[model samples]
Target chain A: QQQVKQSPQSLIVQKGGISIINCAYENTAFDYFPWYQQFPGKGPALLIAIRPDVSEKKEGRFTISFNKSAKQFSLHIMDSQPGDSATYFCAAAKSGANSKLTFGKGITLSVRP
Target chain B: DAGITQSPRHKVTETGTPVTLRCHQTENHRYMYWYRQDPGHGLRLIHYSYGVKDTDKGEVSDGYSVSRSKTEDFLLTLESATSSQTSVYFCAISEGTGGHYGYTFGSGTRLTVV
Candidate 1:
């Protein structure tokens, strides 16, 4: 049923530009939203995450803006750099012990030098 | 990343053959998971274990079985290889329910079923 849906299977951005990716979920039980960054031949790493209680979270150049009422969230990379080029995945899960996650399809982001 | 390792970074097996992928952790985390990655399908959970001898099936557990005899190791086995099963498998570990603490994934194992 594809619980979480992400848009723009791919993206391209110029250096020093703002890169944005969006995701939406249908499950109201989801309270935690996390984003992962993956590089070729490597495992995914946690980039950033946000909770339904907060509207946004920012770490360095990466930011996650969440809309709990709308069941949507977006990742914005400011001053994008070539090193930021990679595949990004958005995932959601409920709060509790042993709660598994539901992930979106994923987006490949390319930042031009 | 947490201390997670996936053996057989790459493998090739013939149809109907059985394959087992191993995941070992040094972090002593209680939660471990096996996930498969494919084009157009980000990552699908195959199975997960909360503690030794306590395991549960995920969304796509068909044709796959898992066992966790110790908290440090979790194994995923393919009963019979099929071309459709060829995909990159990843092992992840988390300290908690993944609600507060995010997961750390292994490099991955590229499995090819011919």
Candidate 2:
């Protein structure tokens, strides 16, 4: 079973526009939600993350809006640039010493110049 | 940037052959993990090690095994490789457990089983 579901297998946005990606989880035990960005030929890196206690978290042009009741979270990239184009993965994990992350299928974003 | 490195960036092996992928870290992190990436599957954990000689299986550990003999190195081996096993393998490390600190991932190893 896919514990985390991410929508829009692929996306395209014009430069300077907004890029949004959404993810939902079935596991209510999940407390930490993290988004990872991966460039071609590279490994996925941490982009942004949010805790269940917070409804929103923003850093620079990247923001994560979370809804605990809905078990959903979304990533918003403001002023999207070509460099921002990559595969994004949403993952959820429960708080523990050995808990592992459960990831979504991932979404490929393309930013047009 | 996190001092994690995956060796043999790419490999192609015949069916039934054995393959081993190596992950080395210079940061002396306490946790090491191996994950596989596929088209429809984002990333599936193969195995993880909390310390030297202490390891555990992940959700998708079948046909794969891992060993951490030292604090800086973790090895993943595929016994009798199969075509279905072809995928990009990534090695990640974390200073703490439960991913509270997130993880530092290596570039990845592209393995092809023919």
DockQ of each: 0.86, 0.79
What candidate 1 gets wrong by more than 4 Å, as runs, is: none
Per-prediction fnat: 0.88, 0.75
True contacts kept of 2: 0.75
Put down candidate 2 lDDT per residue, A3-93, tens digits, no spaces. Answer: 9999888999999999999999998989989999999999999999999888999999999999988889999999999999999999998
- For B1-114, candidate 2 gives per-residue lDDT tens digits of 469999899999999999999999999989999999999888999999999999999989999999899999999999989999999999999888755878889999999999
DockQ for model 1 equals 0.86
Cα lDDT tens digits for candidate 1, B1-45: 448899999999999999999999999999999999999989999
Error of 2 at B98 (Å): 2.7
Residue B3 lDDT in model 1? 88
